[model samples]
Target: MKVAVLASGRGSNLQAMIAEWQEGTLPVEFVGVGSNNLDAMALTIAEKAGIPVRAFPRDNYNDKSEQETDILNWLEDIGTELLILAGYMLVLSPRFVRTAEYPIVNIHPALLPSFPGLHAQKQALDYGVKVSGCTVHYVDEGMDSGPIILQETVPVFDEDDEETLSARILKKEHIIYPEAIRLLANGKVKRDGRRVIIQRDS
Candidate 1:
């Protein structure tokens, strides 16, 4: 699959994706990195890896349709078949969600339906949960609410703080994000409604 990654901050997950692609562990191509923040480390990493990038503010579009159209045009220019949200903070315009004509995937720092949205790791820590993890899911119009792709759990140790728990979960993110991409690339995932069924790799 040809992919364009969108991110809002320093992209550790994006780095993992790029590394996996380079090692040929993930059979995919990342066409570019797009970010709402021009100074995002995601863009810098992409450039260092010799990947193309685009950075534009969500506020630049006066209307949602215009934003969607512009994004679509860019994706077409890059011939991208997948849109991956790797720490991308912007809520997607519904038009972009509906018109991508391919898969849109997102990586969330917590096992979703438990903790979602911003500062998810903090939320989990504050709740004193015994387990915390990461989720990979399809991006729908809603915020952090979408069809699940895959998940891996990490224990929240009794002595763990938010940053520590986040660090542990992020390690799992590095594993599952690339694995999810590989699953899709290899045609092992089938979507039905808000659920994704993964066919066992033979």
Candidate 2:
């Protein structure tokens, strides 16, 4: 499957996905990388992988909808079938959402429906939790409330600060995100209402 990744940061997750692609573990191609911020490092990462890249000026764009339209057209040009939001921060307008019949996945730093949005690792630490994890799920209108495809947990250590906890969860994220892609590419996940049924592989 062809995949487009959107991100606004360093894109450690993007590196993991691209690495999987290079190693032939993921039956996917990096179609393009779109970033709301011009300075987003994902653009550089994608270029390193010889993936096409696009960046837009957030303040100068007419509106998010117009920019998203342009992005969709660009992806369509490349035959991108799946959208993988590694670290894209924008809420996708319904324009794109309505037409994304294929997969649009996002990886979150903490177990979703728990520590969603920013600073997820800190959210877990502040809540005094003993365990935290990462989740790969479909991207719906909700913040992180999509059908979960996969998750992996890490023990929140007693000495853990925000950085320490995030470091731990990120390690697991590297594993599950690629696994989620494998499942999706292999047709092992089907959405039924709000649930993602992990289909039995024949």
Candidate 3:
């Protein structure tokens, strides 16, 4: 499978995926990495890996649609088969989501449904939830509201803050994001409505 990544910040998850791919643990080829921020560390990581990188900074475009159009075109050019979103901050426009040729997946910092959108860790902490975790799911028009592919939970201590909770969830994100991609690459993922079924090896 030919994969591409979209990230906006540190790209820790991208780094994790790259490490697995380099180790031959993940069966996929990274075709490109795209970022909305010109200085995103994800771009640098891609460059270091010798993968193609592109930036579609909103400031350079007249509108969000124009920027997304360019991104879509870039993905088309790269022949991307799977799109993984790692810490990508932009909420994809419905048109873009509908138009993309391949399936798009994202790793979220919370278990989802309960805490979708931005600052999910903070939301969980503020709500005083006893457990918090990460989720890898398909990207739909709604914010973090898509068919879940995988999820792993971690305990939330009374003393935990947003940063601390986020750190814990991030660890799980690194582990599961690559695993989800592996499943996709191996044709082990099946979607049935809002649920994702993972096929076991015979």
Candidate 4:
């Protein structure tokens, strides 16, 4: 599979994927990395990996539609078969979600259906949840409301704060994000409405 990543912050997840790919554990080609922030470390990681990188800073476009259109066009040009969102902060407009030609997936720092948007870790902490974790799911028009592909749980301590919980969830994110891509790349994942089915190897 040919893949492209969109990230707005540090690309720890992207770096994990790249490491797995380099180790021959993930069978995909990273075609490009795109960011809305020009200074995103994700772009630097991509460059270091010799993958193509592009920036679609919101300031450069008059409207979200225009910016997304350019992003879609770039993805098309790169022949991207899979789109991965790794800390990409922008809430994609419904049009962009509907217009994208390939399936898009994202890693969220909390078990979804609980915390859907930004500050998910903080939300989890504030809610007094006993467990917090990570989720890898398909991207829909709604924020983090897509079908879940995989999830891993971590215990939330009584003294845990957003930072500490986030760090724990991030460790899980690094593990499952690449694994989710591997599942899709190997045709082991199937979608049944809002639910995702992972086929077990025979």
Please, what is the TM-score per model?
0.93, 0.93, 0.98, 0.98
Pairs clashing in candidate 1?
none
Give the lowest summed-lDDT range of ten residues in model 3.
109-118
Once fitted onto the true fold, the runs of candidate 4 whose alpha carbons sit more than 4 angstroms away are none
Q: How many backbone clashes does candidate 4 have?
A: 0
Q: Superposing all C-alpha atoms, what RMSD in Å does each candidate have to the true structure? A: 1.7, 1.6, 0.8, 0.7
lDDT of each: 0.88, 0.86, 0.94, 0.94
lDDT of 3 by residue, 7-68 (tens): 99999999999999999999999999999999999999999999999999999999999999
- Candidate 2 Cα outliers beyond 4 Å, as residue runs: 200-202
Query: Compared with the true structure, what per-residue lDDT tens digits does model 2 show for residues 34-86?
Result: 89889999999999999999986677668888888877787788888898888
Off by over 4 Å in 3: none
Cα lDDT over the full model 1: 0.88
Per-residue alpha-carbon lDDT of candidate 1 for residues 1-202, written as tens digits (9 for 90 to 100): 8988888899999999899889888888889888888789999999999999998776898876776677778888999888898988878877788878878999899989888888999899899888889999999888889999999999988888888888999999999999999999899999999879999947
What is the C-alpha RMSD, rounded to one decimal, of candidate 4?
0.7
